[model samples]
Target chain A: MINSEHTAIMLIAVPLLGAFTTAVFGRVSSSLRNIWVLAILASTELLAVLLGVNVLEKGINVYALGASFPTLTSPEGFPVRIILEVDAMNALISLIACTITLIVVVYCLGFMRESRVLDKAYTLILLLLTGMLGLTLTGDLFNLFVFFEVVSISSAALIAFYVHRGQSLEAAFKYMVISATGALILLFAVAIIYSQYNLLSMAALAASIKYTFLDEVALVLLISAFLLKAGSVPAHMWKPDAYGEAPAPVAVMLLTSALVSLYVLFRITYTVFNPVTPTIGWTLALLGVLSIFLGVSMALIQTKLNRLIAYSAIAEIGFILLGVGSSLTQSPHTSKVGFNALSGGLFHILNDVLDLGLLFLAAGAIYYLTRENNMNRLGGLGKTHPVLGVFFLIGLLAVSGLPPFNGFASKLMIYESVYFFNPLFAIIGILGSILMAAVYVKAFYSVFLGVFPPQELGQIPKSMLAAMGVLALLILVIGLYPATVIKYLITPAADALINPGDYIGGVL
Target chain B: MALKWRYQRMLANIAYITVVVLIGLGLYAIVFKQNLIKIVMGVHIMGSGVNLFLISLGYREGGVAPIYTLAPKLEMVLPTPQALTLTSIVINLAVVALMLSFVMFIYCRYNSIDSQDRRLRG
Candidate 1:
């Protein structure tokens, strides 16, 4: 068995190594490049699983870089250098990220067959994955900022991969600008924390946090920057652009990238700030509600399929925020209710990953077939591509939180708990779900059940089919066994977040 | 207060004000400027302002550079922020390069750096 300590770095290094190797060797043979990319991603996924297993077994694993040993602190007992802390929460996210990436890599073999910059695309994908893994796992503040940049830069580059497409460049430019500005603000926040605490390690800062004016400033800056990164409503302008223009596989990766921002938002609020104010929960819920209403309402009118899905994604993020936000309240009764909301939120993250991923892949299939992203131009795909129809239906059902799907299981929990916060919150959430359902149903009818076009359609590739099949299957299984997953994965992940002292204690 | 102490305090205060003013200028440019290049420059200025804030966080009056071998008895400025400033500078440099490359791509495609270009309404 590989030593557990090495697993964290291996998770990051494997992808970084693959990125460079594919860049150099990919030009030699396309088949060779595909195999190389597949091998590294497969291994990375394995390592992620191993790390997750280790986190469950070992509680929390801390790998201090450049230290003589796996010691937590310097001779003076302060955490002085960079560290990678893998808790159940980070482990779960890393696993989700790597799994989605592996699936997307498989799907891309077929999706990206015609693209000119295949090698560059593969390299950027791996780099983005590395950035995400590091962002999820790193314990150092500065390191997180660095990895955030890595993810942003690569994602922007990937979004603009279709250079001939004019809109792609514009989307990439907006995404790049927003991401750069957010990173700068985040750095300023980091500097503020450092100036006060004289430490860069998150655990160290958490142990030393004073909740002063500077701390509040840092908190606001951190929240806004990450909220922008995650594409919340007011800050969500660039998201639809990036997602609508990026290649299908890259679009799925972009969702995970947004997820990383959400993860950071949770990490900063719960761990670093440790619920400094009671209002945090309500504030998140307000944002969540706005995102849900705006995202779904806007999604209703979009002409293009990808943009519609992108809006739905924004709404999905809002659901997660609402569920998690319910728990941030200070009332004892609400805190008890918050645990349930937290579980729902955590469970929804997984559901969102698979459901949204399946939809994007299905959209890509349609795009692959008709070469038309405009929904008005798409018609009668159901008759020609029955399996994709089923896949699309499954994705639509899951996303709209229909019964017997993973989304419903999580959404149910959210509604049940959030009702305790206020009946109106749950009511609005239900109303949003209804609107979301209507939007997707319309999209499905227009795209698949409408008039059949005379143009010849492209056949779906076996690899792409397999990728979608697996996601659909997982969605079904999770929906069926929601209790088992909640008990094992969601509960522990929520506990990890709810109990910040454990995280700080483990490192300090 | 001692003359030396007063001067040092004034210097540090000026540094703090410079940090604030620089960041304000950067934000102004970003929010008010229409040109993409100016916005990119604003991002750079904001980054520099943050870097300056970090470096100033470690500054100590009458302190030597944080080299132990050169001055063992002198009060040394904290070196951590300097190190952090270096890292932030490199990251910012990477971001600036990326922003500029994006600007080039945008210019090549749209023939203008105006943020108002409505190629994508999203």
Candidate 2:
């Protein structure tokens, strides 16, 4: 057995190595490849859970890449090698990425079984998982940018998996252009920082950052690039196209990747550029409100099933940005309300993943059964597949923050905290939730409860149903016991973001 | 002495200004051009500009290659930015190849490489 200390690097290496090995196995037999892929995913998820537990117990774990010992962050009194740091915050995000990837791979086994490009799809999926894991785990700024490109390249390839459809190819092209441009801008910013300080480690840079003129420019470039990648309003034109056209399982991973981009944004703002001015916070808050309004309003008019859900996902990102943005506005001396807002934001990430993952899976199932995604043609599905109806209804309610669901718990935290910060912010958030609920209700009525006769639909594979069931169960559990999750998980992650001193000290 | 100093400063300024122009022209092509292939070339151009900026950050007036085994004892240019530029170049290569392939498929399906064609709209 590998020592527990090496778990951090293993989390990334396992899937990276597994991806190529699976391809070689694919040439031998499909069943062999399936088993190999499943085993690798299962092990990766297990490793993530273990790493999360370790971080919870040990506070923060830092591993220097070329040092004699893994924990030796600074050999010459300064960090000279690449590092992998797992604070409570990173561990939480990595756990979410691992769980979602594992579940989606299981769903893929059923969804893509009939396709000719199954091996290539699986390879790209594992590569994407590696990128996400590396993105969350790395402590070096340059390493983070490399993994960001990795996620973008693999996801763009996967989005165009259906080569027969021109729309998928177009969507993939647009996503590639946006991601390439955004990443190049990010590289330019990184270059500026390196030229200023000759340092690439994030924690070290945070300790020494003086917020000089060039640093401020770098910050602007960094935030804009990450915001574009995170699919915030004004730069979100590529999101719906990518998410709507990609295969269903791949769409779920893409949404998670966007959330990871948001995580990077928060990390940079809170840690690297600590004590940022309130103007930046207000800018984020303004963008959040715009994203909520625009995402839901556009979702209401969407005639395609996956496209509607993609818009709703954007709205969900709004809630998180609002919560964290409000928290940031009170930085350098955060109040109790600010703390609650940050926790609420982190908790909403968990709720959003479960809610949106289930919804996208259901959309995939619909496409699988009827071979159609147009709302005008998909009717009376509930009458034929009551099980799928229940699953989607759960997703819709949770996404809209309806009661007895996890979304309500987290949104309540955000609303109450932001209300204390400023009543107007809370009012806009509540109004957005109301509009989102109406939008999903209309989608539900159209797809599941229409005035059309029942059509002959194929049976949804057991693996697909099983995937949806797991997410639905998690939502209900977290919803019913919000306090338990908030205490053990959300608080630590929020605290990690609130206090950058501990993170800097861990590395330096 | 002043003339030499001014000449060096002028060169540095030219390098920075060239970087800005390259990035600006690339952005113009991406935003205003209609042809898919041109947009892809624009992305590559933007990448080249960033890479050039990175390389310029590491330049020394009289420096040796950053190899430890070399005999020269003169100042070596900052090796880190050069390394970063190489990595960026490789990533850009992958992105350009993937994007051009996507453009090929788009053309094959739509019989047009024009991004303005309505069928590409989602």
TM-score winner: 2
lDDT of 1 at A96: 95
How does the DockQ of candidate 1 come out?
Answer: 0.75
Q: Give Cα-based local distance difference scores for all models.
A: 0.89, 0.91
Model 2, stretches more than 4 Å misplaced?
A69-79, A452-454, B1-8, B120-122
How accurate locally is residue B28 in candidate 1, as Cα lDDT from 0 to 100? Answer: 93
User: Which regions of candidate 1 deviate over 4 angstroms?
Assistant: A70-79, A331-334, B1-11
Q: Write the per-residue lDDT of candidate 1 for residues A1-508, one digit (tens) a residue.
A: 7777799999999999999999777768889889999999999999999998888888988887877454446554645557888899999999999999999989999988987789999999999999999999999898888999999999999998888887888888789888888998999999888888888888878888888998999999999999989998889898899999988889999999998889988988888888568687789888999999999999999999999999999999999999988877752233667889988988999999999999999999998888889999888999999999999999999999998999999999999999998789889999999999999999999998978878877789999999999999999999999999988888888889878888897777
lDDT of 2: 0.91
* Chain A fold similarity by TM-score, each prediction: 0.98, 0.98
The window of 10 residues in a row where model 1 chain A has the poorest summed lDDT is: A68-77
* lDDT, residue A462, candidate 1: 95
- What value does the lDDT take at residue A232 in candidate 2? 86
